[model samples]
Target: MAGCGAGEPGDVRLADGGTFRQVLGLEIPNFHPYRDQVAAVYSTLLYDSLVNVTPENKVVSGLAGKWSATTTSAEFTLRDDVTCSDGTPLRAADVANALNHQRDPALAPAAAAALATVPSFTADADDVTRTVKIRMAAPYSFIVRLLGTRPIVCPKGIAAPADFEKVSAGTGPYVLTGYTSGGPYRLEVRKGYHWGPDGARTDEPGVPAAIVLSVVPTPATAANQLIAGDVDAFYTPDPDSVRAPGPEVTKVEVPAVTGMASFNQRPGRVTGDPLVRRALLAAVDPGQAAAVATGGKGRPARGVMAPAAFCSGDTVSANRPAHDTAEAARLLDQAGWVPGADGVRVRDGKRLRLKIVTFATSAQLRATAEFLAGEWKKLGADAVVEEVTVMAFITVTQQSGDWELALGAGVTGSLPSDAVPFFSGPIPPRGRNAGAIDNAEYLRLIGQASALPDEASCPVWQQAEAALVKRADVVAVAETTAIWFARKTRFQVAADTTIVPTSIRLIRG
Candidate 1:
C-alpha cells in the first residue's frame, strides 16, 4: 500500500447492537439544516423534506405523498400517517413553519439565501388530507429542487433557534440521542418507520440500529482505523492509497464536490481591478494546483458545478483561463504595475500583493493556497496565505475588505439554481454574495433561467454560467472526489452529495 494507513478496523460490532461509526475531521458547528455539512448529514437522518431528488435528477416523494405545481405556486399533499421521531403526527402546519423559517429575512442567512426564490408558505388540512401550498414571489421553475434541499423540522424549532441543534423532533428514521462538542455524536434509529422515499423502510435487514459520528482530526489516523477494522468506513484524501490489498475493504468515489477560489471584487480592492484578477488567473493553472492539493485524486474542474450536474455543459470549457506567466506579467505592466528590484510588482508605492483566506482544517485547501502563492511569486505578484477556522472563514467571506481571495469547496445541487446565493445578490451582511459580483447581464440571465421550466432553461443557464467564467468571479479548481474506504458497509453515495444515510446497509460477512 503506497499511501495507505497502517492499521485496520477489525470486523467487530460495538455494544449498542450494530452502531455504524463514521469519522469527521471537523466538528459540526450546529445541527440546524443549513448550519454546516455535518448538520446537513444529520438532517438527512433526523428530518424529512417534502420531496427528494434522485441521483438521476428525478423528483421523488419524501414526506409528501404527492405534489403538483403551477407557474406561481406548488401544492403538496402530505402522507396521513407520517410521524416525527417524538411520536407526534407530522402536521401541515409544521411544513409551513419549516418553509417560512428558511425564507425568513430576519434570520438564518444561509437558509434565507437558499430560499430567497420563495416568498411565502401556507398550510391547510381536513380530516382526510393534509396539504401545504407554497407561493413563489415569481415563477421559480426549480421550486421542487429548492424545496428538496430544505428539511422540514418540527414547528417547535421555528421559535427556538437552539432547538434545531439540540432537539430531535423530525419525521425521519433517526433521532438525535446525544452530542458532545468534540466527538462521539450519536443518533438512534426509529422503529416501524415505513414512510421513506422510494419505499425505503427502517426495519430492512443490515440497517444499523444507530449511527455514531466521531471526530478523528487526522486523515491518516481515520484511514488506519478503517484498514484495521476499528472503523466501518471513513473518507480518504486518495482512495487508491488507502484500501487494503484484500477483498475485505472497498473504495467508493463520491462526486459533485468542487474546490474553488473566489475573488473579492469590491471597488477599491486589488482584485476589483479586472486586469489583476485576470493576471492572477493567468499566472497559475488551476488543474495543476488542484492535482497537487488533492494528491492527484481529484478531477480537474470544468465549471461551477460538476459535469454530472444537470445544468453543466460546454459553457465552462469555453471560458477556462490559459496559464501564461508572461501574459500575467504583461497584464500587470498594462495595469500600471512595474516590477521593482526584488522582482515584486509595484504601482504607486503599493506592491502587487494578494491575501487568500483558506481553511486551516483542510490540508488539501491549505496546500492549494501555498501552491498558488508560489505560482503568483513566479509572475512577480506576492500572494499571502491566511489560514483560519471554518467559522472564521465564513465570517471573512461575508465581511467586505476582510479578504482578497478565498480558497474553499462547495456542495452541488441537483439543479443549477441552488447556486444563486453565492454568485448573485448583494454582498453580506446583506446577502450571500461573498465575491461582490455585480454583473447586470449575469444577474439578468440567471433570473431569466430561474423563471423557466427545467426543460427550457438549459441554454439560458449555459449563457449565465459563461458570464461567471468570463468574469472569473469564482475560479473552479477541481471537482474533488470524496474517497470513501469501507470495511463492511454496502451503500451508494450520490454524485451531488457525499453522505446518504438512508442508503447505508451493513455487509454480511
Candidate 2:
C-alpha cells in the first residue's frame, strides 16, 4: 500500500459495470477538435485519429486499417465499416476534409503552428475502395506516425464548428451525450465500437459502459474523492501528502519540462544580443531553479521535449551553459554593459533589464522567477517579474512585445517535431514563433530531419535541439511532474499527462 509501481501497465484488469468517473480541475469551454485552447482532454476522448501510436511508438490502426507513407506522399486504406457518432459513414473524403480543414484561418495559434510543418495537403479520395492518397506540399518523413496526434473530424464537424460543442461527431468509442460549463460532462459508449488503439473495443468486460468527466476544482478534494472511491481517477499535484493511505489506489507520476526561460530575440531588444543572452544564462543556476519550482521534488531537464516524447533524448544536457557569475559579469562587461550608479548594468544609456513574464496560477513558477531575479541582481542586471491571468499569459507570449524573457512556459507535445514552429518559424501574428528566433542552423537541421523517416531522423533532430541551447534561444531549466491517482479504475499513461482513452478499465470490488 505504499504507491503504484512505475513499470508498464499490467494485464491484470478488473471487471465492473459501473460508469467511470474522471475528475477534472478546469471548466472546458469548447469541444471543437483544434479550437479547445485550454486543454484537449475532451477532444482526445471523443475523437479518433487515422492512426494511434502506443507509448512504445508502435503504429496501430484507428480509422485507417492499412497505410503506406513516404517523404512526399501517403496513401491510407480506411476500414470499410467505420461510422461516426451520428451514424454516417466515415468515408475517405471525410478524412481528407479533416486534414485540409486545419488550414482554416479560424484555427488557434498553437494548433496552426502544429500543422505548419506540412505546407499543404492535397488529397484525392476513391470512394470505391475507401482509399485516400495525400500529396504533401513538402517532404515530411514522420507522415504516418505523426497522424497519432491529429484527430480526424467527421463531415458533421468540418462544416459546422458550433454543432460539435454539445455532441461529438467523431468515430471514437464514446459520444458526448451531455455537457455543462461547470460540472459533469457525460460520455456514452457507442455500440460496436471496434476502432480503438491496438484493437481495443467497447464490449470488453472491464471497459466502462459510460464515462463521466466531473469538475473538482481543488486538487486536495479530488484526492479525497479518489481515496473514498467516489471518483475513479483524478490528477493531483502533491499526491504523496494528499492521497489517502490505502491499497486500492494507484499512482503514476510523469516528468515534463518546467521553469524554462525563452528570450525575445527580436531586433533592438536587449536580449537580442547573443552575448547578453549567454551572460543571462551564465548568471542563473538551473539546478536551483528546478528545485525551487518543483518544491525540491523535480528532475533535471533532458531535452526540448518532455521525457516521454517520441523523439526525446539528452539534447539539452550536453549543451547547457555552466553557472558562473564571474563569467556572466565578464560577458556583460565585454558587451559594453557597465555598472551604473544604482548597480544596474547599463550600455549607451539603456539599462540591462529583463522582464520575466510568468502566469499567476502556478506557485512553482512564481518561486522560480523570484529565485532567478535574485540571482540576476548579483550580476548587476535588473530582473522584473510580471504575473498575469492565464489568457493574458497566452496573449503576452503570442502578441505582446513587452517581455524580454518568458518564464516557466513553453511548447509541450507528444512529438519532438511539435516544438518546430515555436522554436523556428514565422514571428507572431503570422506564426507561433513567439520569441522571434532566427537560428539558421536550427532551421536547416530541423528541415533535414523532418524529411526523413522515423528513427532515422533522431540524430538530425538532436543536432537541431543542440543548436537552440548552444545559442541560448531557450533554457531547459529544471523539470516538473504531474501525478494521477486512480481507484476502482486502471489505465496506462504515456509518460506525459495525456490520458490514453483506450487504456481505461474499471476495477471490480
Candidate 3:
C-alpha cells in the first residue's frame, strides 16, 4: 500500500475473450521443470501435473483424476478425458515415461530430488483401468503432494527430449505456440480444456483465453508497464521497487517464501570456520535487512517457512542472529583475526575479505547484499557483491570455490519431505545442499522424521530445520511475500507459488 499509487483502469480484453498480458521479472533460461524455478512457471502453462495445489493449499487431482498412496508406493489413475494439445490421449505409458524422464541420473541432484520418493514406476496398460504404479525406496507420506508438483510430458516429447526447447507436448489448458529464451512467450488456450485440477474447466468465467508472457527483468519497468495499461499483471517479491499502483489495481501477497543467504561451508572456505560464521551471522540484523530489502514492505523471517506451512515454526528463533558489532569483533579476535592498519581484519597476511554472489532476479537482494557488506565492514570484514545471470548463479552455486556467501530465494511446501533435498542432500555441487553443509545431527534428525508417519514427523523436522539455522548454515533474512499487482485482471496464485496463467481471468468491466 505504501508503494502503490492510483492509476486508471486499463481495458482488459483483447480481440478475443481470453487473451491478456503480463510481465516476468527474469528471462526464462530453460523450460525443463527440473532445471530451474523460472522454467517451472512455463511448465505449468504448457503442462499440467498429475495433481496441483490450490490457492487454499488443498491438493487436487490434475491429469490423474484420482490417486491413492501408501508409504512405499503410489498409484495414479489417468483421466480418460485428458489429451495432449496435439490430440494424443493420456495413457499410462506416457505418465510412466514422464516419471522416468524426471528420474534420469544426468540431472543435478537438487533438480532430480523432486522424485526422491519414487525410485521406480510401472505402467498398467489396461484400457479399462489406466494406472501407473510408483515404487519408492522408502515409505514417504507426501508422495502424492510431491508428484503433484511435477509437470508431465507426453511420450513423444520424452522420446525426443531435445525438441522441448522448440516445442512443448503437454496436456495443460494452454499450448505453447511461440517461445524465445529471454524474450516474449506466447500461449493459446485449448478449445475444450476440461481436465484442470479439481474439475477446473476452460470455460470457467475467470479463466483467461490466452496469455502472453512479456519478459521484463526489472520490477520498476514491469510496474510502469502495468500502470500504462501495457501489461495487466506483474509479480515481484520486492513490491517497493514497483512503487505504487492506482486504486484500480489489485495487490496480492504470495506467502511461504524466504530470501536468505547461504554460506559455503566447504573445508577451505572462510565461512567453513564456525567462529567466523557465527561472527558474521551475529553482525547483521534481519529486521533491518528485511526493511531495506522490501523498502519497509516486508517482514523479518521468524523461521525457514511461513506460518501456514505444515513444518513452519519458530525453530530459527534460538539461532536468529543478533545485531551486536562488539560480539562479532570479539569472536573474530578470539579466532585470531586482528584489524590491520586499514581497519580490515587480517590473519596470517590474508585479509578477511569475502564475496557474495547474487543473481539479477531481485533488486532488493542486491540492496540487501550491499547492506550486509556494510554491516560486515563494521566488524573489519570486507564483503563485496557480484551480480550475474540466473544461469551463472546456478552454475556458481554448484562451483562454490570463489563465493563465501550467496543471496537467493527459497520456497517450501506443506510437507517436510519437500524441503529435505535442500537441507539434507549431498554437499554442494553434488546435491541441493548449496552450502556444502554437512551437519550430522541435522541429517540424523531428518532421517528420524523421514521414518515417522505423516503428521507425526513435524516436531523432528522442525528440530532439524532449527539445527541448520543454529549452525549459521543459512542466514534467515525475510519471510518473503510475493507482492503482485493486477490491473483489469484477476488471478489466483497457489499458496506456495507465484501466478500460473491458467488460473488468471480478466475483470469483466
Q: Which candidate ranks first by lDDT, i.e. highest?
A: 2
lDDT of 1 by residue, 1-509 (tens): 11111223244331224778788766776777744445765577888888876666667888887888765677888888888776778888778777776766565555766655343544444335688877776676666666645788776666676766755767888888888887678888889887776657888766789988888766667878877777777775434344352567776665644457788988767888878888888888766877876778775676777666777766655675678888988888999999888999899999878898987767777888899889988888778999987668877887745778988766356567766767877677666678888777777888788678765787898888778878767677776675677766755555455456666676555
- In candidate 3, what are the lDDT values of residues 166-270, reduced to their tens digit? 567888888877888677887788888888878777776656777888988778888888888888888776776676887778776666445667888877788
- Per-residue lDDT tens digits for candidate 2, residues 18-123, read 6989987676777776666453545668888888877667788888888888878888888888998889988888888787776665743335656765557677
Ranking by lDDT: 2, 3, 1
Per-model TM-score versus the true fold: 0.88, 0.90, 0.89
lDDT of 2 at 121: 67
Clash number for every model? 11, 0, 10
Higher-lDDT candidate of 1 and 2: 2
Residue 354 miss distance in model 3 (angstroms) = 1.6
Model 3 — which ten-residue stretch has the worst lDDT? 1-10
Misplaced by over 4 Å in model 2 are: 1-15, 39-41, 107-111, 215-221, 224-230, 236-248, 427-429
* Highest-scoring model, TM-score: 2
Model 2 earns a TM-score of: 0.90
Mark the regions of model 1 whose C-alpha exceeds 4 Å error after superposition.
1-17, 34-38, 105-110, 117-128, 236-247, 256-258, 294-299, 361-363, 388-392, 399-401
Predictions in order: lDDT: 0.72, 0.76, 0.72
